[model samples]
Target: MPGFTLHPFTLLTASTVFMILPVTVQPAITTPINAALHAVAGPSDATDRYRALVRRLADNDPRWEVQTAAWSALISDVPTAVTDFLSPGGGYEKARARASQNASRNALVISRTISTTTATTSPIVHLTAIRASYGTLAEKDRYVRTGLKEAQDLDAKHSPVEQARQQAQQDRDYVADIALHGSGAWVRAAAQRAIQKSTDNDIQEFFKYSWASAAGCDLQAFRMNLVEQDLAYRHRLAQLIVLAQQAQHAYEQASEAAKAKAAAEARLAWSTAADTAAATQASWLANQQLAAAQAQSWQQVHDFAVTASTQQDWPTIADNAAGTSGSWSDEVAWAQSQAAEWTAVYESAKASADALPGANPTVSPSPTA
Candidate 1:
């Protein structure tokens, strides 16, 4: 009968004790939170520590479980603090802003590095082009100078502009010609740089036109020298022509003068020779006449004297004839007297002829009748 009795008080007390023990006061979760904070250093360490804390908190609190989910999603691939996490319409708008700023900063740094590399390498390429262009220009300049000097040394004739312009043109053409011929990569690069660097339209246009003009690289230097040479040759030809004319004129004048002088000498010589021949003829004629007259006079005297000698008885006749005959001379003595008189007359005539006007011995005698 003692085993059959039921106790409601004992059953109520057992249920109450079970409920109270299950719902008792828990220790603070601050200890694990402190541990997680202390472990934070870098992103990797922070991520590990945060994950562990999330698991611990998930054991007790529903809010902790929710926070853990959010943190897990935030730091999964992106290592970050829970305080710096981002979500739409969340209370971490500032945290999101900070994270975006950090990303932008990193991007800017990478961009600067790339820009520096390009700037440095680009100049080197440009420099190489410039060096090539310089070599081409220098070679062209040297060739031009050689041609110019040769022309100068040889005294080649040319126009004034051609002579001076060749030198200036060589300098200008070297750059321009190289650009036109595309002789060097540097030339194109330099031109581009100049255009890019300069803001002025004048400078840009100048380079463009200059380069275009130099493209041909012809033999302008030789042509210029040739022009000068042509001018000099013309001058020399003119001088020769003038000298020939002068010589011809002088020869003509001299020939005329010589002819006149010869004519005058002939005239004088003919007149002198004729006068001498006439004087000689006149003297010989006079001597013959005088001798004949003297012979006649002597014959008359001799005949009369002979007649008186035969008639001696007539003394008066004999005396008269003798006196007349005594005055007469011999033929030889009379001829001598006539010759002396003619000689004096001929000498006077020769002196008078010599003093006559227009009597030049150097000229020849003129025509006579």
Candidate 2:
């Protein structure tokens, strides 16, 4: 009964007082909030200071909560900025245009950095930074296109010597492939022979454009050697042909002698002579074929060298020459053996033919006489 009773008007007035008190205290609450905002979003010059502060906080801050909050604030704007820059038709185009217009200084700096740091770091890092500074992916792509265009233009402006160098490199690779792997053993051999005979100048100049090193060996020597080897093989072929002709002549003589011999013993001698001559003739034919193959191989190598020289493809000349050295020696040995074998056959045939009655066989008077 002693407690006071509240009226509706009294209750409403009490609620109003509570609301007025909050209004009066609002400034006190807002002061700290405003101060916090100002600190986080400082003046324009604050960017560098803020970055330094963030790094310091991350590196040396003792409080984990403070460090975490600093990191969060630092990265909070990254996603939004990235989205605005990357989204199609976003305001990135203006930034990209500005970047392009102002990129000269940045480009110079980047170039210098690249040149100086090339030995210490990968070039990709500089390239990536350069691309990023252009502001947007589309802008970076344009930059790349422009760079490629300039490079192509430069290549187009290349002097004849440069063009020749490129051609020489290509030619060298081609000749090397053939010399090392050609189907013809003799051609391969010829290539090797040319290499051994290369001149100093040829080696020095030709190797410049080649992928392979020549250790001061002449690449042009291969072609020249091929030509010389071809001549030698041709000479050998000519000799073989003459031997074949002589063997054929012996065969004819033996045939005639066999037909004229009436005595059984003389007939046997004539028959034996004819057989020897036939074998010799067969051997001569084989040698002629071998000689032709060898000649063809050498000729092929020579022709390749000539073509390469005409094109100024020193690499090819060099490669061909170097590739054929071993094979050339083998070819020479084989040729010598073949020559010896044929010579032996020819001598045996000649001896047998000579033992037969001279062109005139003294036929004993016919048995009827």
Cα TM-score per model = 0.17, 0.22
lDDT of each: 0.31, 0.35
**Candidate 2 lowest-lDDT run of ten:** 14-23
- Against the true structure, candidate 1 reaches a TM-score of 0.17
* Residue-by-residue lDDT tens digits, candidate 1, 62-170: 1222344555654556434442232222223332344345434444433443354332344332222232222222232332335324433333342221111122222
Tens digit of lDDT per residue, candidate 2, span 1-369? 011111211111111110101011112121222122222222433234334334444443322333454455456666433223222232223333343454454455445544654322433344333333322222333445464344335445641222222333444344445446442333233334334444433323333322222211121222223222322332233333333334444455565456444233343443343343344435434434433443344344445555444345445654554444333334344445434443443344334334444433333211110
Candidate with the greatest TM-score versus the true structure: 2
